[model samples]
Target: MNTVQLERMKNDKGFIAALDQSGGSTPKALANYGIAQDAYKDEAEMFQLVHEMRTRIMKSTAFTKEKILAAILFENTMDLKVDGQYSADYLWETKGIVPILKVDKGLADLENGVQLMKPIPNLETLLARAQERHIFGTKMRSVIKEVNEAGIKAIVKQQFEIAKVIIAAGFVPIIEPEVDIHTVNKQAAEDILKKELIEQLKSLTPDQKVMFKLTIPEVDSFYEVLADHPNVVRVVALSGGYSREEANSKLSRNRKLIASFSRALTEGLNANQSDAEFDQMIGQSIQSIYEASIQP
Candidate 1:
């Protein structure tokens, strides 16, 4: 791992920007940004349009290292450019924000009440490309819809199993096992998950380090133990499905867990806004999220 990036990630005060919406989620992400399905006719055009939107965000003066510790990028975006530079390189070199690639193919069909990541057969090749671009780390996600201890264990286990490979490849891994916010027994599931994660952390060697991107727990700071774990670099909260205001409110309560929000972070942005309007909007979003990320 790059020691400068590692040091920044270990003690950075700002939140991560999740700009990694994938193939399955792109339509929804575009729709939320005021682009309809009819706006782009095919996958190629759709990706092109979304890339434009991302370029706008990245090139904005508002998007900088002071308020953004890092950004999680899609594979498509990783291969593309921003203002004449590779997306990852632009983020780190020009803006001082670490760039991370989302490496999971997608989620598998639910089994045992959980959704594991689809196989990433090309992860080794992907990591090599990322390394060449000065990328710092990788993130992969799976989901838990309800409380099933066996299923939850499977999710965490899968995350770590892949994380070890990522570690060996010399990159940090941000393992995200998202718990559905709508689950009636969400707290119960988180409790079981907390225990399983502790067991996994205890098993790691001192040199191993990983970051976690998790849902804002039902109770404030419920994952403090995980946050404080020596093997962990930082603990970040996913907004899940909350509105931006609601996400920020909940995030402030967690204190230690910084934001790695997708929808919530880009809730009001639109492709139609003028440059001045766009910058102001993103600036406000960054400020709100930064405040919550560093909340005491």
Candidate 2:
């Protein structure tokens, strides 16, 4: 890795705040907050709302470098302006927060609830755009909702393929193969995921590196293998569908993992909230997740 990439890898770990809501997630979130689907009117307005929320949260005194290492942004918000400067620039210059882009198009067909990210035919273009905008890294996700062995292997292979592309493009890739919290064979699936992930890491040449973002496993130390691997700069946890309290309790069990939570991090925040209420809600969420990440 070059100096910039190496430094970004260092800055891109720990209690990351995920705001990369694609069409698949955005509508559901807007609905949950009682914002009508038509309220945004179009994609531009939707992107504006996301940027507005991020600006509000990042401007808080409580939301500082010590609490959040980076924020993963959806494609539309990557180049948006926070002040006179671009969003990434403002975050870095003002708050020491690295900006990462969400590169996955969306999910494809499902099998036993396991799904692959839809292919991006113009991934190279997107990577160039992210780099042009000074994005520090990128994240992509696939699912392991069940213990289908072939499905598990396919997800691992696909993520590694994309990960290689991201690394070659001079960006740290956050490879997320998330297992559902409600899956029946959760422990077994975690074992499979850990094994496959470790095998993939072993295949990399000495200089190759990437980060792993995974569901907090049932076993407290299930992901220690990856955490200890030289190629893995950090390991972060997703909240799945768990509430904030539940996510925090489970995430605290794993000494190696920190958070990159979405819904759990945004819980109790709503579009209707006043500025003070918005800051207070997001501040509390950041504190809770930060405490879990730094647990002894």
Candidate 3:
């Protein structure tokens, strides 16, 4: 890990709003706003809608720099322009918000809930592109379905293995291992996750640090160990499909694990709203999430 870059990321810790919806998720989001299937038949046209969606979100610029430390963007967004300037540069220059890139492809089917990221043959090239765009970090995701000890170990090991590559490329890696909230053994799964994460961090070289975006655990302090670990730069929580209010409530119970929410952060926003209304909804969301992250 590059200590300088890792420390830079640690210094910017706060709520990270995730705008990294994939091709699969984009259609679902557009549909929620009453967008018809005929609205955009092709992938290229759909990408424009995604760009519009992000532009609409950016109208709430007043809240971006203050409440959000960074924005996690999809690959398509990395090269997008706003007012003739690149979106990443616009965010930093106009709103003081750092930009992070989501590097993983969508999930692959593994066992029931265990997920592996879809392979990205050009990951190194992607990281190089992110650097060129001045993005500050990168995030990738995996999932855990149940509390099988062996499965948890394998997941943690693989995440760290990828993190090594990310760190070597001079970017902070947000390693996400989402534990499905519906799992019956939620607490047990978190316990295993905590142990495995700590053991893996112990095995890493001293400078190899990674950020975490975990589901809010059943036990509030289940991740407290990593939150304080030297090899961990930051520990943030994923909303994991929770309602905004629900996510805020759960996240408030934990110290150090702040918000890095996706769905919950965009809840209640719709394409039909006027610019003022849209800004109001998103601004309110940033406020709620920001407050939850700093709760002591």
- Give a tens-digit lDDT track for model 3, residues 12-129: 5468888888888888877875576699989999988978888778657545666788788899998998777788877777777778889988788876447767777888999988
In order of appearance, the predictions have TM-scores of: 0.98, 0.94, 0.94
- What TM-score should be assigned to candidate 2? 0.94
RMSD of each: 0.8, 1.9, 2.0
Model 1 segments beyond 4 Å from truth? Answer: none
User: In candidate 1, what are the lDDT values of residues 35-144, reduced to their tens digit?
Assistant: 99999999999999999989898889999899999999999999899888999999998899999999999999999889999999978998999888888999999999
Best by TM-score: 1
| Global lDDT of model 3 | 0.82
Candidate 2, residues 232-292: lDDT per residue as tens digits? 8888999999999999999988877889998888888787988888878888899999989
After TM-score superposition, what is the CA distance of residue 127 in candidate 1 from its true location, in Å? 1.1
Best by lDDT: 1
